[model samples]
Target: MRALHAPTRRRAVLIVPGFEERKITKALAAGADEVVIDLEDAVAVDSKAKARALVVRVLRELDRDPARSIAVRVNGLATQWAADDLAALAEVSALDSVVLPKVEAAADLVRARELLGRHPATLQALIETPRGVQDIDEICRTTAPLAAVVIGYADLGAALGRGAELPPQRWAAIQDRVLLAARASGVAAIDGPHLGIADNADFRGRVHWAREAGFDGKWVLHPGQIDTTAAEFTPNPAAVEAARRVLAALDEAAERGLGVARLGDQMLDEAVAVAARRVLTQTEGN
Candidate 1:
């Protein structure tokens, strides 16, 4: 199990409906770290087969880029279309991963792997229900090519009887738990999309909260949300410079056989150095 890191500067993820060809192309070039071609919620009941075929065709035709991830969100395991979706995707060499929606336990991942056969595409678990959230630790710990565990707020909120509209703070505790599990498992923890097209202020606030809550990235439904999401998740230039200075000071002190150092009014130790290093790491290749 290798540690999964954000692939793009924005650390933004965009999900394009599999049935929408134009949207797929737009998402791929939209500066998102990952673009998930959705075959689940975005497609209608009668369009599953057509969407799967279209997604496969699009994937086969697209140029593969190692720097960015291109994944497909197949329908839930229990759905009739999942098996066919997995089978069709098993041989798509251009795909980076498979987004498994509505995962409830470790068994769900196991079943998906079984269905996926020997395909090397990694798995991103979409935890949408109460059971999925409760068993998130186990899901994250599963040994199957797991890359990230994303929280799906729409279905989750509905399952929790919270209705369609949910405040960002309402998800704080759940976000913390998912982040904790992903950290322990050495995988990326992704926050779900805001599920709204308008209300730019509200969207920015939600993105800010996710960044502050320590999420590796966020799912953006529309391309317009990409820049804001990326900007908010990205560390400020001043902060990155400050972190570099702190690291430089700490490294110099260590070379002098000192375990601690002083930078202005702040005492720098291994703990402070650790935080600075994280900030610098986030800015890598920016």
Candidate 2:
């Protein structure tokens, strides 16, 4: 099989489950890279079937473009509705991905793929529980067609008996593990949503932290967070130019039979070139 490419867009917004056509339309217009029609935590137990039906209809209508990158957040395998959810969505050819919640093992992803049948939808795992975190390496390595891995902070914090606010050091350790796991597995590592929606300062700080820690992007729960997330993930023009210079200097040095090059006062080598290439790749079309 060929390698899977990372998503070009950085922000993903989740719409509450069940039918809310107007809200979905507004979310798509909010400039998010993708819109996930959630059928898991957002939907109530009684509305599962209704939400499933509505998502199918929406997928059919939106599948026409295929470039819109629409996805569904299906219930976990342990739930009664999960099988039915996959069976129904399997027929939709336009679905770009499925967000599988409570994925604790590679088997969960394998089952999701089996139910998806011959469809082209990719799987994005939600690492929310302790088991999921512990088995993250195996889960990322074994799961095929895995596009991204997201840290569901709310559920994870709850599982760890952490309150609404987690200590910065503790949270950093968790985030770093997820980031490294995704990197080693060649998939995107997306930070979970920041619940402090009203606190712009806190939200921006979190976004900055995620970028510094090497996350590809973050989940945005509100429309207002879309631009913030996108801006944070985008490489600054100055940084991009500097990266270009690093590559140019390295290329010139290689031609001169030198293993290292000087960029300003700092020495540039293979290690620095890797980061420079990443900057160019991340900002390619931006």
Candidate 3:
């Protein structure tokens, strides 16, 4: 099996594990940066083994391209299927990562790594519980080989009992905490799916809010969401150009022994430089 690595693109979509080959193909063609074949909530209890076998076959077929970032969202540690799911996937060279759902503590990550047993597949934790949110900082610090972390808003909302009608500010606060934790740990921070699959305006609004909150990306639930999320996460051309100009201006100032520089009416400092570099990094190879 090839070594595991981080995904290059921003948008990631979750596909049920038992999807037909053609459906999987169409999803990949829909412009998702990463495709996660879900084995947890998406699969029926009795169909776990079958879904696992199908996922393995699909991953082997998809991994040949090398450019495709394919992941599997295995059942949580509390489930009977979680061990078998990891064991089965450990031998697949094409698997880039495993999404471990309901990660509430650092020990869960440790157990997952041990189950993976030297395989190159990275782990992306799904933070869905109140304990997971509270211990997020410690989880981030202790977990090794963690590629990214994503909010599982549906489960989290249920656990918190905020209901479907919770205020927007409440959700924003939760997302901000997850984002801060991921950023502090120097890993990708992905926002949860919007859940309003057919609501383009709602999707765009949520995507914009996530982008503005400094999230790396958002989960896409449908093929229709793929293009919209991908576009939303990608830095705009004007922003990219402005970032380049900031770098250039900083370089010129350094050459002239200036401690500070001005870009229009705004002053350029380390913070501005950092933001500009982030823009360039995000837009690389676009």
Q: Supply every candidate's count of residue pairs whose N, Cα or C atoms clash at under 3 angstroms.
A: 0, 0, 0
For model 3, what is the error of residue 154's alpha carbon versus the real structure, in angstroms, after optimal superposition?
Answer: 1.0
Query: Candidate 3: how large is its RMSD?
Result: 2.8
Please provide TM-scores, in order, for all candidate models, with all chains considered together. Answer: 0.85, 0.86, 0.87
List runs of model 1 lying over 4 Å from the truth: 1-10, 242-278
Prediction 2 global C-alpha lDDT = 0.79
Instruction: Give the per-residue lDDT digits (tens) of candidate 1, residues 41-111.
Output: 99999999999998899888987565677889999989999999999998787777889999989888888
Best by lDDT: 1
Query: Each candidate's root-mean-square deviation in Å?
Result: 3.5, 3.4, 2.8
Candidates in order have lDDT scores of 0.84, 0.79, 0.79
Q: What is the Å distance of residue 176 in model 2 from its true position? A: 1.1
Error of 2 at 226 (Å): 0.6
| Residue range 1-286, candidate 3, lDDT tens digits | 5664445555555453454666766666666777787889888898888888887787667634445577889999999999999999998887888899999988888899899988988888899999999999877876568878888888998999877435445688777888888778877788877667664676788888878889878888887777777777778999999999999999999999999988899889988897787787667723
- A best-first ranking of the candidates according to their TM-score comes to 3, 2, 1
